[model samples]
Every structure is written in structure tokens, then in C-alpha cells.
Target: MMNSREIIAKRVAKFFKAGDLVNLGIGMPTIVANYLPAEAKVMLHSENGFIGLGPTPAEGEEEKDVVNAGAAPVTIVPGGACFDSAMSFALIRGGHLAATVLGALEVDEKGNLANWMVPGKMVPGMGGAMDLVAGARKVIIAMEHTTKEGNPKILKSCSLPLTAANEVDYIVTELGVMEITPEGIALRELASGVTLEEIQAKTEANLIIPDKIDIME
Candidate 1:
């Protein structure tokens, strides 16, 4: 059985297709790159200023300068390019990306996201999350099902400051995959060995579970 993080990453990776320009946000979202199918031919964008980002480099093979937006050493695929922040924001704000996978602290039934800062904790700033969620053609959230204290991160309404209003399209977690729709949050698939009752207990939002829910691959 795969661990929780790997389960989420593997499930989230299925959303991308060939030729898609995707931005994998820091944290859990970055793991999606490792699970992407080799033939997908997806191009990764880093907000700090690079594209064609590859998976994490082996420990001994780390490049001194090549890194993702998270400042973690990474590999650049062949034909990848590096540029200034101006160009990076231009590409993002221009809505050229097919999708952007991000991690979130809270996601409400209305698809509102709040992930940047937790009130008392000092943070550098909101970073590119604001632009990424609003600018990306599709915003996919990759995060755990619950907080460390066993609190539901998916709620009927977000308590934290929102990163974007009604912008999230999909939410992928260790327990299941959910899609925000006009009606509400739809439970599309459940991870193997997890039950509907288990998911509902961990989710504060009312899930629209279909009769024929599929198991996550």
C-alpha cells in the first residue's frame, strides 16, 4: 500500500495530459511530478522563473543553481528554459497554463481556498498563489484530507483568509478525489480501503456522492 502523500500524488497526476503546461505548487503538489506518466509530455512551470522543470534530482547529482520555486534543487529537462520573474508572471497572468496544482490549508464547499498564512504565524507573503489560482485555466488542489490534529480541511465555509474565491476546480487528497461543481463538492472517487463513512467523518463539507463511485488507481 502506498503512503498518504504518494496516494494523493499518484491520483492527482492522472488529471494532466500530453502537452499540458502545469505548475506544481510547493509541498504536496510537487510530488505529482514524480508520478506523472513519462509519455504525458507535460511542461512544468515554476513561479520563481523557469519551465520544463523535472522531478527531484538524486542527492549526489544536485545542480548548484537549478531549483524549483520552493528553492529545492531540481533537474531541468532538455529544452527547458530559465527567465526572469517578469516573464514568469506574464506567462501565469496571461492564462497560458493548462492547470496549476496547489496545496491548501482550507478549501470550502464553494471552492474558496485559504492556504497562504495562518494568522499569528509570520509568512513571507502570499507569494504567487493568488495569481496562480486566479490565472491558471484550471486550479487543482493537492493536499491531505485532514489537518494534523484530525480536523477537516474541507469545510462548508473557510475560516482562514481566502487565496481565491470559487476558483478551485478539483481537490485531491489521500482519502478521495473531489470536484467543485455548480451544485457542490462531488465525491468522484475513493482511495482503496477507505469508506464513504470514513471520508464524511473527515470532511466538514457535504459531499455529493454518486451511486457509482470509482476507486482511485
Candidate 2:
């Protein structure tokens, strides 16, 4: 059986159609590659300066120089090539990316996203995320339904520092799929064995459940 992380990524992949130029965030979002259709033709872009990346290389088959922005070893597809970071940011800043899958620390009802820093925690800094969110044609978030401490990540408002304001388009977690709409957060789908009651109980935000919700298979 797939774990919750794998399950979330698998569900999120369905939103990435062929021909999309996608940038995958480092953590849970990275697993989406493993779940994409083998026949689908999608271009993977890395903010660190590569496009047309294939997928994570198998163990022992890694190329030390080939890595994504997250520094994870990856394989390049046939047409993939590396460029400098300036060119990479140029693509992102120019809004050339069709879609971007991201991992979130917290997403508020108003679609505000907070992922870069936690108070008193150490991190290098927020990299290209601000540009990615600003420029990507559409943003898709993949993350857990709740934090390890059982705190809801989908909230009425983020308590942490925000990475961006009012940009999140869609959210996919282990328990459900939600869309950020002008009205509020709309619960679009629920994973198998998850209940609307459970989602509402765990979430700190007001979840709008449509009359018809897609039950994830």
C-alpha cells in the first residue's frame, strides 16, 4: 500500500496534463514524478537551471553533476539541457512555466501560502519560490493534511511568515483536494477512507464542501 505522502503525490499528478512545463518543489511534490503517466509527455523544469528533466535516477546510476534545485540527483530527458541560474530565473520570472507543484507549511482560506520559514528555525532562505508562485501559470500544492504534531496545515489564516499572498490555486493533501476560490477554500475531493467530518475537524479553516465531491480512487 502506498504511504500518505505517496498517495498525496499520486492524486496531485492527475492535475498535470501533457505539454505542461512543470517545476516540482523539493519535498512531497517531488514524488509526483514517480506517479506521472509513462506515456504522458511533460517537460520538467528545475529552477537551478535545467529543463526537460526525466526523473530521479536509480541508485548507483546517479550523475554527481545532475541535480534539481533541491539538490536531489535526477536524470535528464532527451531534450533536456542545463543553463545558468540567471536564465533559469528568467524563465520563471517571465512566467514561462505552465504549472508548478509546491509543498506548503501552511495555506490559509484566502489562499495565502506560508512555507519558507518557521519562527526561530534555521533555513538557508527562501530561494526561487517567490518568483515561481508569481510566475507559474497555475500553482498546485501537495502536502500532508496536518503537521506531525497533529496541527492543521490548512487554516483560516497562517500563523507563520508567509511566502506569498493570495496565490495558491489548488491544494492536495493525504486526506483531500481543495481549491482556493474567491469565495473561500472549497473542498473538491476526499481520499478513500477520509470523511468530510474528519477533514473539518482537523482543519482550522472553513471548508466549503460542494454538493458533489469527487471521491478519490
What's each prediction's TM-score?
Answer: 0.94, 0.94
Candidate 2's C-alpha runs over 4 A off are 58-61
In model 1, the clashing pairs are none
Count of clashing residue pairs in every prediction: 0, 0
Worst 10 residues of 2 by lDDT: 117-126
Query: Would you list the C-alpha lDDT of every candidate in the order shown?
Result: 0.91, 0.87
lDDT against true structure, model 2: 0.87
- Model 1 agreement with the true structure over 58-108: per-residue lDDT tens digits: 889998889888788988898688999999988898999999999999999
lDDT of 2 by residue, 94-140 (tens): 88888888988899998899888887885657898888988888888
What does candidate 1 score in Cα RMSD to the true structure?
Answer: 1.5
Candidate 1 Cα misplacement greater than 4 A, ranges: 57-62
TM-score of 1: 0.94
lDDT of 1 at 33: 85
